[model samples]
Target: MKAVILAGGEGCRLRPLTNHCPKPMVPILNKPVMEYSIELLKRHGITDIIMTVHYLSSSIRSHFGDGSKWGVTITYSEDGMPLGTAGSVKLAEQMLTESFLVISGDILTDFDLSAGIQHHEDQLAAATIFTKPLDLPIEYGVLLSADKKMDKMFEKPNWSDLTKHSINTGIYILDPKIFTYLEDFTHYDFSKDVFPAILKHNEKISIFEAEGYWSDIGTLATYREAQFDMLHHKVNLPSKGKEIAKGIWMEDGVTIHDDVTLKGPIYISRNTIIHEGAIVGPQTVLSESAIIHEKSEITHSILWENSYVGKSCSLGGMIGHCQIQDHSALADMNDETVNAWREYTKRDS
Candidate 1:
């Protein structure tokens, strides 16, 4: 079977971090977020992939190359223009001559794709969407289905009816015939355009409620939460690093001073250094080559690759590529903080 990974979204909500890197390249546990999606596809025995790339497309191409390392053959559909979701895949319509699954490269999930494909095949529908039931379906749209057939999609409907349905996961299995609904190489979204057109024509559209961990990581908060989820074993991925102790993971070349406080549920990636008197608190993630100076305290925060925290500094929230000064503190992160960081980065570079 084949798959189309939608890797083109720029992730406007996850700015500051997404400023320099593509959404798919966003690091999760020191690994590219899209890499987990590739690993998931490999586990389901779907090795042939076509990734639709835009917005720092080179980062993806340079990192994965031909995808041989993951045992998948990847061919990119590089978009010269911003071809939304459906249009991006439409660019590679010729390559998808048969049934194919479409998933967001930035999303992290351990869903059973094979089972979802089997459901789609059994139904022989025009398309099958993968969905997950939210514990509190407050913000997401509700896709109501009857006997596995899509009934109606409501945007932020009354919560009284929320428990009866599942939210769309932006994962789908589609027949090649569905391409007829999409215009050639034009920008279109599956939810806003193509699917509505299919529904207008009374074509078959099915929904499969998947059972597993699924996170879109749309915001900076969710991005950190997803990594914390991994630390807590909420989701299982064959991730990097070794768990040296309960809830504590360290990768190669990690150097920690004996006087430093090592907290559980913390992940220190390759070549990270923690100096004397530093407190590596719970839910702290230090990416590759990140350095924590003496007596610095990092709690519930994330430091991207090579970011440095100066002596006695205290921090929280996401820190992008940075060299924070000694005794500096940033406890709350908002849009203003993000813009300031971006400007700081611009000047620092």
Candidate 2:
């Protein structure tokens, strides 16, 4: 079966991080977020895939060219302008001749797609929308059903107005004929326009309640939660690197001097170095080639590739490629210096 990955979102909520990388390319556990999506699709035996790209299209194209590295054939549909979710998939209508699956690229989930497909086929519905129960439904589009039929759909409704906690997971098994409802080069979203229109016409749309982990990493808070979830094994993501010590994973060429303390549940990527007297960890991630100087301390933080923490510096929270001077905290760094650091750490790839 063909799969359509909606990867074109600008990710305005995840600023700074998304400033350099596309939303799909955002790092979770030192791996691009979409990489996990591709792996998940492959695990379900769905190899023929189409990815829709808009912002930083070339970067995504370059990173996973032809998808051969992942043992899948990848076709890209680039948008000249921002096409809404459904509109973007419409651009690839020719490739999606059969029933297909649609999923957001920015989300991190291990939802059983195979089961979802089975449910879709058994019901013989025109479209099947994967639904999950959310404790807080205000931020998502709520799906209301009665007698096994969709009755109402509300997008980001107030708490007082909510009747159902089941929300759309942005994963769908769609019939190709659904393309007929969308126009080319126009902005149209599945939740805001297409799905509602289908319900209005009394078309059969199945709703499958997802059973496994699902997280839409749309904001920094969710991103951090996803990381912690992975650390706790709440989600079944591939191991980031070699587990050299208990709760501490490190890649090849990692250098650590004596007297450096590394707490558990941390990932140190390739070629990173922790100098003497440095204390790292307890839910921290150091990206490739990061340098933690002598006596520096980092806890509950994520450091991007080639980041430098000077001697005696203390850092917590999300930090990119910025360099912290000796004895300096993150707040001591100015915006100009941070921008310069980001530019310096920019990857040519």
Candidate 3:
């Protein structure tokens, strides 16, 4: 079956990182976030795919050209303007002739798409939405289903009005017939417009309660959480590099000097250098060619490609492609300088 990947979101919450790249292209464990979704689709035997792109579309296109590397045939549908979730898929209507699956590119999940497909076919429903129970439902569109049929839907409901914690996971098995509800070149979201209209017209909308790991890394907090989850093996994400030590994964050409302490659950990408007396780890990711100088300490942080942490520096949070000079701590950097560094990193990287 063909699948539609909505990869057009601007990812405003993930500011500095998203400033240089699209949300789908955001790196997690030295790999683009959307790459995991593509891998997941491949695992479920869904190879034919269409990706909808808008903001920084070229980045994604260049990264996964034709999806050949992943053993899948991928076609891209570019939107000249912001065409909301379902609207973006409508642009590629000709390519989706049969029943198709719709998923968000920014989300990471190991959900059983095959099982969800089977559920959709067995019910013969027009659309089947994958839903998961969330402890905090205020940020997501909540759904109330009875006997697998969606009874009511609420978009980002307030705490007082919340009736259920089951929220939309932005994964859908949609029959081509559902295309009749969408219009081309318009801003229309599935949750805000299409799905609610379907319920109003009394059309069949089934809900598949997902079982397995799923995370929508929309904000900085959740993004960090997703990294930690992968490190802890909460989700079965395939490791990219070789496992040099028990919990440390390192790519080829990585240089580590003696006296450098690396705690478990850390990933150092290709050609990265960790100098002597440097301490790094415990949920940290060093992207390709990153440099951690002597006596530097990085904990629970991410260093982007080619970023430099000078000697004796200490960093705890996200560090994009920028240089932190010797004897400096992240806390010591002024807001203006940090902003300038972020801008410079975006431009240079």
Candidate 4:
């Protein structure tokens, strides 16, 4: 079966990182989120895919060209204008000749796609949405279902009903016939427009409750938490237990000096260098070719590829590409000293 991955979102929430790169290209544990989705689809024997592209389309095409690297064939639906979720699918109607699945590129999950498709086929519904239960339905809209079949969708209800049912997980097994309900290249949203229209027409739409690890890493906190989850084996990712040191994992050709101190749960990509007296770690990621200068400290941050951390520096709560000025230092370095230190201080002074 072919699958359509909705990768056209602007990803306004993950700014600066998504400023240059597309949302699907954003790395989760040094691997693109879109790659994980592709791997999952390939596992289910869905080798043909149509990825809807808008922002930084070339980057995505360049990264996953031909899909042969991942044992799949990828065709892109390059949107000239910003098309809504359903509209994007409508734009690729010609490619989706049979029943297919539509999933968000930004979401990360190991939901049973085989079961979802099976459920869709068994029920013979026009569309089958993958749903999961959430503790806090207020944070997300509650999908009302009866006897394992979706009845209505209530968006963010005011009162908390104990019988609060499932929520849409943004994964759907859709029959090609559903495309007839969508308009091309228009601002037609799947949730707001298409689904509601389908409901009005009294068409068969079902929901399948997923049972497995699932997460939507939409915020900074959730993104950081996903890294921790991968470390703890709560989620299955490629880099889960690849740690070389106690909390550090170095790729091939990484060089670290004896004077360099690395804390646990840090990942340094291939060819990264740690200079003398540099302290890296406590949950940090130094991408390829990143240079850690002498006496520098980094904690709870992610430095993009080829960034340079200056000498005598401390970087905390940071992210993405940068070049630190030489001789810069963070204030909380000297625990014994209760006063602030100069930003640029000489070693002899």
Q: What are the models' TM-scores?
A: 0.91, 0.92, 0.92, 0.89
Question: Please, what is the whole-model Cα lDDT of each candidate in the order they appear?
Answer: 0.86, 0.85, 0.86, 0.78
Q: Listing every candidate in turn, what is its Cα RMSD in Å to the true structure after a full C-alpha superposition?
A: 5.8, 6.2, 5.8, 6.8
In model 2, the number of clashes is 0
* Candidate 2 TM-score over all chains jointly: 0.92
**Which regions of candidate 2 fall more than 4 Å away from where they truly are?**
242-246, 331-349
lDDT of 1 by residue, 1-349 (tens): 8999999889899987888899999999999999999999999999999999999999899999999999999999999999888999999999999999999988899999999999999998999999898866666667888888987776667877664758988999998887898788688988878888888999999999899999987877568768877877778787788888998988989899879998877899988999999998666789999999999988767788999989999886555676889998867667764554454335434
Model 3 worst lDDT window (10 residues) = 340-349
Q: What's model 4's TM-score? A: 0.89
Local accuracy of candidate 2 as per-residue lDDT tens digits, 117-153: 9999998888999999998878899999875556778
lDDT at position 267, candidate 4: 83
Estimate candidate 4's RMSD in Å. Answer: 6.8
For residues 1-349, what per-residue lDDT tens digits would candidate 4 score against the true structure? 9999999887887776788988888877677778888999998899999999999889999999989999999999988898888888899999888999999998888887998999999998888889888876665557888876767776666664537657788899888887777766687877777778877878888888888877776765556556555655566546622666555676787888878888877788877888999998776788778998889999777778888988888887676776997787543234322111121112113
For model 1 the local lDDT of residue 171 reads 95
Query: How big is the positional error of residue 160 in model 2, measured in Å on the Cα after superposition?
Result: 2.0
lDDT of 3 by residue, 152-175 (tens): 888888888777799999999988
